[model samples]
Target: MRVLLVKLSSLGDVIHTLPALTDAWHAVPDIHFDWVVEEGFAEIPGWHPAVAHAIPAALRRWRRDWRSTRAERHAFRARLRAQRYDRVIDAQGLIKSALVARQAIGPRWGLDRASAREPLAAWTYRHRVRVPREQHAVSRTRALFAAALDYSIPNTVADYGLARERLPVPSTAPGDLLFLHGTTWPSKHWPEAYWCELMALAAADGLRVLLPWGDETEHARAERIAVAGAGHGFVLPRSGLGELAALIASARIVIGVDTGLAHLAAALGTPSVTLYGATRPDRTGTFGEAQIHLSARFPCSPCLTRECGYRGASVVRPACYEALDPARVWAQTRETMSGSREMAHGA
Candidate 1:
């Protein structure tokens, strides 16, 4: 059976949808998938064995200046509509995602009105499946795919079907530990001081720390962190998603804030310690083996807002992150690494 899976932008959201393909791959016989994802995250779907094609969706880019990109938008629509599939599943329950799913040639399926984040998105789906929203995002997606594709949801832990050999290993020696500190939201960012402390802590423990940066701000932060970490810490050159994925795959342990790379580490089955301040870990934390999450003990935590309500309320910008300090994160990181090493040695 051929299926077109529509799950668009936001790096974290795209990562969250991987395990569902794993589930579908295992349960369905000869099931082929074509995934529609944001152009930036186009590399992800191809990592899965079940995905025959990773259809690039430039919705985010085209929408920036819709009037100027009419021809490109038209071409994208034409390409999407050209392929007739057995099923087009809209894994993302947003209106924009619904629109994308509607453009595909197939019997559409998605979360029903009550289960969808944007209830109106359900209108586009011919077969509306009701998956509970209370569960973690990974579990919810697994259930959604099961319902959409006529298979029972597996009881076992989620498996993101990414292979080690598929990734191109970087030529540089792998760092003993990788620190993924860059995040999209201000409230989600762990303080630079805290990150610097963790880098120094890792260095003191005879661990080489690799810090990756995407933009100028993150580069600056990494530079400061590398200096604080002394000789053992190094800042990596600006890397693409694939390069960063390779780095994540190569690291002995990954220590990160609540970022998409943290999710990538989880998906890659890398032992990781993820610190959560403003966000709740239970609902959408990193899922998979050898993953640990530390959420802040603040009243306004998990506010689910881009901006912090308690800014300037305490020493930390978000104030909630005060509880999730460097010492706390470092301790957890050490414990997780120790556990991973012991497990590796069959202890």
Candidate 2:
């Protein structure tokens, strides 16, 4: 079966869809996948054994300069309609993904109006499936694939089918910590001061702390954290998705906020602790083995908003993040990786 999968953008969402491909491959040995994904994350689909290749979609770029990008849009549409697929599945319930799925040549399948984020997206599919919205993102995608492909939803731990060893990551030494400090929302950021303290604590215990950044602001924050730590914490060179995956896969431990890299760490099966403040873990926390999720106890936590609204006086600016202080986060990280409360302080 040659399946066309339309799941575009947001690194974590793409990672969540990997297990569904694995399910399809296991359920039907002859199944192969060709993905329509954002050009930025194009390499990931091909990493899975079941995937034949990725057809890069530049919707984000095209939307930026729509008038000038007509030729590119035409070319992309041509690529989508080039080959007839056994089934075209849009696991992402967004209108953006639905538009791409509509252009693909196949018997289209997707979430029903009740299940879809954009109800209109369901109209494009020949077969629409109803999957509960409350489940984890990984589980939801798996259910969608099973309903579309006519297979039982495997009652097993999701297997991403992409191993850490697939990347050419270097061998990292023991007691090295990779801090995934960058995130999208202001409400999701664990305080910079908290990060510095955590790095300092790790360094004092004879650990090497590694930091990576995607933007100038993140680079600056990382630099500040490194300086305040006054130990082995240092900023790595700018890296791409594959390089970041390699880094995450090879790290001894990962401590992170709600970010795509945190999800990547989970996908790689790295020992990781992901901190949650404005967001809850029930729906979309990092899903994999050896992963720990720490959510805030603040009253307005899991706010699900991009910006903080609290005007109350608190130790932490976001306020909700105060529930997940540096000392607590570091302790959790140490305990998670060391697998013992005794080793939480790096004893």
TM-score winner = 1
Per-residue lDDT tens digits of candidate 1, residues 1-347? 99999998778888899899989999999999998899999998878899998888888778788999999889889888887999999998999999999999999999999999899999999999888778898998998999888999998888998977788777556898998888988889888888888888888988898999999999998999999878988889878888889888989999888999999999999999988877778888999899998899988888888878884569877778888888988888888888888888995
Mark the regions of model 1 whose C-alpha exceeds 4 Å error after superposition.
311-313
- Highest lDDT against the true fold, candidate: 1
RMSD, candidate 1, Å? 1.3
Lowest summed-lDDT stretch of 10 residues in model 1?
164-173
Residues 1-347 of candidate 2: C-alpha lDDT, one tens digit per residue: 89999999799999999999999999987999999999999988867899998999988888899999999899989988999999999989888899899998999999999999899999999999999989999999999999999999999999989855556554443237899999999999989989888888988887788889999999999999998668688787887788778877767789999898888888887889999988879899999888899999988888999999988989886889888898888887777766733354666
The regions of model 2 sitting more than 4 angstroms off are 170-175, 340-347
- Displacement of residue 95 (Cα, Å) in model 1 is 0.6
- TM-score for each of the candidates: 0.97, 0.95
The lDDT values for all models are: 0.88, 0.88
Error of 2 at 210 (Å): 0.8
